[model samples]
Target: MNIPGELYFTKEHEWVRIEGDTGIVGITDYAQHSLGDVTFVELPKIGADVKQFQSLATIESVKAASDIFSPVSGKVAEANKKIEDDPALVNRSCYSEGWIAKIKMCEPSEKNNLMDAAAYKKFVERLEH
Candidate 1:
């Protein structure tokens, strides 16, 4: 799976790319693969207040539907409405155009609760065995 080194991760299989005080969030490559072809995404609402590890979104796939958790607390600054129209973007490019939301961080320090890519890499590996 493609786990970008710059991002932080949650055990729930989400990732967050920190940019300034904003965090762009999404599910990891491993997550998309496990879910099979994605059919829909319930994008978070803009201006919504979300807490760390809370249900930030819901994704439906050929295999199952799952709740995607936030990696940090914040207000939803933006939601990727593009995914609402074409959910396949999530399967095609989970790291970039597929990001779910951009959150205006309430506690940047909450990032510490998440795993670095290397640690998440090891975490996924452990799951494989």
Candidate 2:
């Protein structure tokens, strides 16, 4: 799994890359791998309000459909239209071009609830066993 050290992770397998008050969110590499080849991504509407740990988007793959939860509470600033047009981008490069949304954080401090790469790596290990 490509777990970038700078990003924060959630137990539900989403990642957040915070830049100032905006946070870029995506399903983790582990999540995309588990779901198999992605076929669709249902993006949240721009300007929509979302809460931490709540469902932010949905993804469908050949194997299953899964809800993507927000790693931090915020307003949906943007959704990656690339993934909408080519959901396979999720399987191709989940951490980069496949990112799902960008949120304008309501409270940056809520990021403290998330895990670092090391912690998330352990979390994924636990799930594998």
Candidate 3:
């Protein structure tokens, strides 16, 4: 539920921090809270291609395993190796150190499909209602 104002969010609950053409992706804080303790992260390879809304990685928590979809189509340029070794980073710092992948976007305009913090907050609110 910690939807920072700087990031964009997908309906799938993925968050993206866009820095120029590169975007850092992660599950929202709300997602990790719902998932409970994270135990494992299956990351995409550095050079792998992932399309918008496609499954890019998987995370296993105490409750269940979940696929993390790409927020935008792009080539994965890097992954957070720390999460593989200490998945709790996701629980502790979902928006920063716990980021899953860095992508070099194939279509920057896909950002338009994402929701800003206020919009996403309302979206989550609607889901609760």
Candidate 4:
């Protein structure tokens, strides 16, 4: 339920912390909570091309496995290797250390397609009910 004010959110429950031409991406707090303890994270490879709303990676939790979609078109810049050994980092620190990938956005304007903190908080609240 922790919806940060600065990052953008997707309907599928991914978030991107926009940083200049780079975007740091991860599953939302709500998503990790819904998925339960994450057991695996299939990170996208560095240098791979990805499109907004496309499958960026996959995550497996005790409850179920789910796709992590990209929030913008980009080339993968870095994948968090720490999660490979301890996926629970996602459960422990999803907004910081547990971030899934860093992307070099090909189209920054695509961010407008995503929701801001206010909208996404409302969106998640609706889902909760």
Off by over 4 Å in 3: none
Task: Pick the winner on TM-score between candidates 2 and 4.
Answer: 4
lDDT of 3 by residue, 6-117 (tens): 9999998999999999999999988898899999999999899999999999999987999999999999999999999899999999999999999999898999999999
C-alpha-based local distance difference test score of model 1: 0.95
**So what's the TM-score on candidate 4?**
0.98
Tens-digit per-residue lDDT, 42-98, candidate 4: 999999999999999999998788899999899999999999999999999999999
Worst 10 residues of 2 by lDDT: 58-67
Q: lDDT (0-100) at residue 35 of candidate 1?
A: 91
Clashes of each: 0, 0, 1, 0
What's the true lDDT of residue 124 in model 4?
96
TM, every model: 0.98, 0.97, 0.97, 0.98
At residue 116, candidate 1 shows an lDDT of 99
Mind giving the per-residue lDDT tens digits that candidate 1 earns over 1-129? 799999999999999999999999999999999999999999888999999999999999987889999999989999999999999999999999999999999898898899999999999999999
- After aligning candidate 1 to the native by TM-score, how far in Å is the CA of 40 from where it should be? 0.4
- The lDDT, on a scale of 0 to 1, for candidate 3 is 0.95
Question: Cα lDDT for residue 105, model 3?
Answer: 94
